[model samples]
Target: MRRAPRRRGPLSTVVGIVLLALMLFPVYWMVNASLQPTGNTLRGGWFPLRPDLGGYATALRDQGRNLVTSLVVALGSVLLSLALAAPAAYALARFRLRGTDLVLLGILITQTVPGIVVANALYGAYADLGLLNSCLGLILADSTAGVPFAIVLLHTSMRSIPGEIVEAAQLDGAGRLRVLRSVVLPLSRNALITAAVFTFLFTWGDLLFALTLTTTGTVRPVTLGVYQYIGAHTNQWNAVMATTVLAAVPAAVLLVVAQRFVTTAATDGALR
Candidate 1:
């Protein structure tokens, strides 16, 4: 016998379509605006009738340095945050240390504070240490903001691993590091990739700390670089739109590449 087909309600279909359009419309507009002629962006005309690459070309040329800086800071932040957070996560996941829950809560609580408040103190500290306007300083600052979340996410993923696996590895006379390297690390790849992607995105899009910490275009990220188009006397909408679109490409690519891992990581983390 043939099964009956399921039917979606009118309101449900309408709401789904509306949500999809709402999400996609901005992306479509960004691409449309990026391809539009420089002068027509502010005219509020329909979507570009004759699109061109002139805006993209100008943005690439003007913001190339900033893009490079952003890439460096973001990549550096991801690497450092993951490196620092991973071992801590592993410990929390595998060990039964006293007050571990309290420690995790403390780390999570740090996220509640505004970045600006921390930035004030960080800026002064960076200046005192002669680290202002430096890529290393920015990398450190961005990593600090990202590490807590990475640790929490990674801990949850690690905790999902079966305790028996660790016991088996231990029975084989494996050392702590060996057991972690062979057992825990392999199982936690998805979580690591997710954490790295999230950290990269956060650092790449960070503006407040980037602006407050870095003084030179050589060190400032793409997010801060886009602001150059807005001067006291003039604003360049075409360039700004083009740059914003370009800035989003890396994040989009990262998500695409890590798409499978992200779902696994989130599920494992949430369930644990």
Candidate 2:
């Protein structure tokens, strides 16, 4: 006897396609605009029959400082966040401390406070210390915002490591630091990559803090660089789109490279 054919749900299929289109549309538009000529874009042309690379050239030459600033800040934020968060996450995951739960809860609660609220006080403090217009200062500020989330995510990943593995390391005459380096780190590499990627993306995309803290082009990130395309009388739409596309390339590359790590870390956390 022949078996009946299986069928997909109409609502589910429609919803999935809609979601896909919604995600893809912005990417499509960005690419389209990036290829458009400056004059054509300014005139509100919809499509580019004769695409040009002039906008990209202009963005690279004119906005190079912004690109460099973003790269430096992102790299710094990732390193700083991981350096501090890895140890804190390890301690929270592997050791039992008094008020551990309360500490974790406090970390989570800090995320609830708006960035703007913290920025107000932090701005004054940074100004006093002469850290307001520095790349290192921005990195420090961005890393602070990222550390709590990284700690929570890394803690979840670390907890997924079997307690027996840690105990076995201890039995093998390994010290806490050795166990962490040899056993915990190897197993938690995926989580570490995930944390770094998130931290990089957050620092790279930040504009409010960058704008408030940085006074010069040398420290202005790509998000602020895109703002330069806007003028009182005339906006450079082609350059804006081109610069935006360029800005997103680093994040896109990072995501592609670290996607497996992100997936594994998230799934492991969910199952646990």
Candidate 3:
């Protein structure tokens, strides 16, 4: 005879739903607040029964250029971080060089150093070199966050590649660079995507470097622009909240678009 199917506990399901709601409440509040009529946020109702979009219009008008600036900086940082970190990670994974562990430990140590310290030191050098107020300067500074984390991720993924596979490629007359380009990178696609996604997010949401590295309006990113909005237009809470919502869109869209690659990384046989 067939057995009855086991049922999940209703209590557990309800508790899970409650936790999910709690996690998502802030986002709901932001959307709710964004839709309220101007100057009504202080007494806005819980639901947006009558939504207004003037706040979004104002946000786009005011923050659009900064949004573009953020995209440029974030994309540049992702490229720079991956270009530098990928090769370093590959070397660390494949080579048996002396002090490889020490090198990696140093990278980890850099992560612990405060961003303010790095920015302070860089300010003097940038002034001398004239990198201040430039897109290139912001990109380089933002990569300080991306490079080390990406290196750690890519190194772990590359290390998990079967030694026999790499040896077989070498025995087949493929050079190290060719093998890495064709075999290692192809196999590590998920890891690369993971690194790229995170690097983009890190650079996109960065406010510290944008604030520290730039002084003029020419290169302001959305984070800094939002900060300025807060200071200059404190009464415009609806617009401010709308800008905050808009700033989150790219991150949300990226996670959705890259969900497959993320799942592959999580479940792939290599790390298992």
Candidate 4:
């Protein structure tokens, strides 16, 4: 028998709505600011009585190229991280190797290390390898954020797959690679999507790597572009806010589209 969903009391409902409103007020205010005249946003009204598109026009004109660069770098990071992470996760999950717990602990530790430390270490290596300021360099740097996290998440998900199922595949004369490709990946689809979504989000918003690794205007992510935009257009708050809104769109859209998978990926492991 199915359990009925829990119902909230009036007070609980009111509290939930108030909390949601508090969280969303800034986003509402950003849109309100973006629609104001291109002058001082501080003088703008609480609501935009005269909405202006000029801010959006100016933002796209200035930062469109940088937006594309961010998209490219984000997609590249997702692909590289997944390619490297998936196999490693599969091996660590299925194979009962020696000292596996220590290795997993080490991977977990990387998450605690500050991103600045990694960027500083990669700086000299990037310079020597001629990767600085290049899309490839940014992709590689961003993948550092993605790979370890992906491995840990994917490992947990893959481990939940039944051993009998994996052994059955092997019994059918399937090799390790084949089982991973045909069976494991198909079963772990939700976890894979969750990993990719997070990786893309992290790479899309990365600023530290963009600032540290690149010196010239030849390449820049939207995050760096926005930082520079703020420096250059301090007086034009509407344009600045417009650029921020644009920067936030991809992330918002991605989250809405992938909400189901992320929810499923979390529950799937626990239930298994």
lDDT of each: 0.86, 0.85, 0.92, 0.95
**C-alpha RMSD for every candidate:** 2.7, 3.0, 2.7, 1.8
Give stretches of model 1 more than 4 Å off: 1-6, 232-235
Question: Which candidate tops TM-score?
Answer: 4
lDDT per residue (tens digit) for residues 1-272 in model 3: 99898888999899999999999999999999989888859789999999999899999999999998999999999999999998899999999999999999999999999999999998999999999999999999999999999998889889899999999999999999999998999989998999999999999999888899999999999999999999988878899999999999998999999999978886763546
Q: Model 4 — TM-score against the truth?
A: 0.96
Weakest ten-residue segment in model 3 by summed lDDT: 263-272
Backbone clash total, candidate 4: 0
Model 4 stretches astray by more than 4 angstroms: 1-6
Q: lDDT tens digits, residues 1-272, model 1?
A: 99899798999999999999999998988888787776647674557788778878888988888899999999999999988998899999899899999999999999898999988889999999998999999999998888998999889888888999999999999988998888888888998898888999899889999889987766778888877666621445676788899999989999999999999887776676
Score residue 206 of candidate 2 by CA lDDT: 93
Which residue ranges in model 3 land beyond 4 Å of their true spot?
1-8, 267-272
The stretch of ten residues in a row with the least summed lDDT in candidate 1 is 228-237
Top-down TM-score ranking: 4, 3, 1, 2
lDDT of 2 by residue, 1-272 (tens): 99898788899899999999999988878878878877546464457677878778888987887899889988999999988998999999889889989999999999998888877778999989999889889898898778998999889888888899999989999999999889998898988988899999999899878888887765688888777556521345677788889998999999999999899888888788
lDDT score of model 1? 0.86
Q: Higher-TM-score candidate among 3 and 4?
A: 4
Can you write out model 4's per-residue Cα lDDT over 1-272, one digit (the tens) per residue?
Answer: 99999988899989999999999999999999999998999999999999998999999999999999999999999999999999999999999899888999999999999999999999999999999999999999999999999999999999989999999999999999999999999999999999999999999989999999999888989899999998899999999899899999999999999999999998987787
Best by lDDT: 4
